[model samples]
Target: MRILLDSFVSFFRNNYMQLAAALAYYGMFALLPFLLLTALLLGKSITSSQEALEGLHRLTYQMVPEFQAVIFNELISLSRLSDTWGWVGIVSCLSCIFPLVVTIRNVFLTVFSAQRKRPVMIEILRDFSTTIFLIVLLIFLVISQIIYDELIIRFFMAISFPLYIVDFMVNLTISTVGMTVFYYAFIPVKVGLKHICVGAVLTSVLWAVINPTLVFLLKLNPKFGIAFGSLKTVFLIFMWVYFSFCVIVFGAEFIAQWDRRKEWGILSTKHGKNGVKETSPPLERDPPSLTP
Candidate 1:
């Protein structure tokens, strides 16, 4: 109870939503460069353009279901020019990924760290490393999802379970596992897996539920983004990305609170001031004392 309360309090106090908004803004800007970089990599590895496009479509739709068509089209357009980009353009695109990664590192530091700042060079190096880590992790996630869709889903379909439900469950599980590993690896503080798993699962579930709801809302009201005029797609995408960052930051706050409780000795099971264990035994070996 105390942990939950503290988590909420710290969440609002930290202004996590505002931070998420900032992150979303940067993320929006970074998207093009990241996609271009990805396209360059894909162009080198995938000999067939059509197969690469299909893979990108699948990966994009899997990651961000909302406004995927817009993103997919953009990816297709950018991929065509990927092969033409020289070293200058390639370096330029790679440089754009750093700001977003730096922002993420700062956000995590704010939530999970209390130490003073480091040198600029050290910070830059760490940010570079984190950027590489995230990019690699994303590639791994894409591969994992592809494998699941290609093989695991086929096996499950043989059992007669609905495809939609199975996909959702698989996505939820993968998202949970991904977020858990992300928090564990990304946070500046040393934390146990048990401490981060709860927040990761909660974030994954919320994300899963909200995604379908957003799609449903859009389907129900075709003019939901009518007010945004021609920029409706961009507006919707930014809003969705913003919401995603908010959920992610909230999960970080929850994990921090869990770690905080342990630091304050509230979650300790060792002997207390009176030499009695703070936590109860697994099995009750003694009757309750009638005398309070």
Candidate 2:
């Protein structure tokens, strides 16, 4: 119990500042994209004249009574915007790269806080490349999803049960892959693909368990309710950004601990004097004179 308490204290002491900075940085980048995406999605409903969109909006309003007006107004505005600006919007989205660099550097430093020096450019480059790859992979996954929706939906409708299972497995597999990619990309530690796979699976399970609870709590926050009324979803968006940072930090620590345990044996036994029983230091018999 003492060890557990110590660990928790250590985590907060070591990570709180970096976590806060990273969250703030990422939150700023996330806000525009998040709002734009929400708008586009809602606009799609209007374009298709889908009653389901209204139902979803209503449900969201009910769940987050405080933010209903804000969310609704944003969605309405986004729907009105011309699609031609999407390319320009995407180009501007690159602004996220700067803060992402800072956040990634901080995450790397946090993971290797025991190291003597800060990460160098080469180290940063490697992490950046891997992150880019992961982003590309995620894009591919999105494209795959689009294809499924466009071409496979009709075929799958005929065998919905089997298709449902396949889709679930595919999503799980992709999520695990994405997590593993991120673990290797961001953490400065060496982890095998197999270990990453294991960590990813564990992360997925944890996320599945925690996500719904988090959503429920976020909806319950009265401040979010107020912000939604004012056409500003900033508070809720910031909360999610911070929540994401916490999850990433927790996942990194979990994977690091797992790797350390495997490599160095149980954490409890990894740091004692080499096979020797611990004892109090011998008392000096006499005070020694200082000599050059």
Best by lDDT: 1
User: Candidate 1: worst 10 consecutive residues by lDDT?
Assistant: 283-292
lDDT of 1 by residue, 77-118 (tens): 766665677899877766888887777767777777544278
Cα lDDT over the full model 1: 0.73
Residue pairs in clash, model 2: 66-225, 67-228, 70-228, 70-231
For every candidate in turn, the CA RMSD to the true structure comes to: 9.3, 10.1
Model 1, residue 89: C-alpha shift (Å): 2.5
User: How well does candidate 1 score on lDDT at residue 290?
Assistant: 15
TM-score of each: 0.84, 0.60
Best prediction by TM-score: 1
Per residue, candidate 2 scores C-alpha lDDT tens digits across 173-223 of 656676777777666656767766776786665555455666677667645
lDDT of 2 at 251: 59
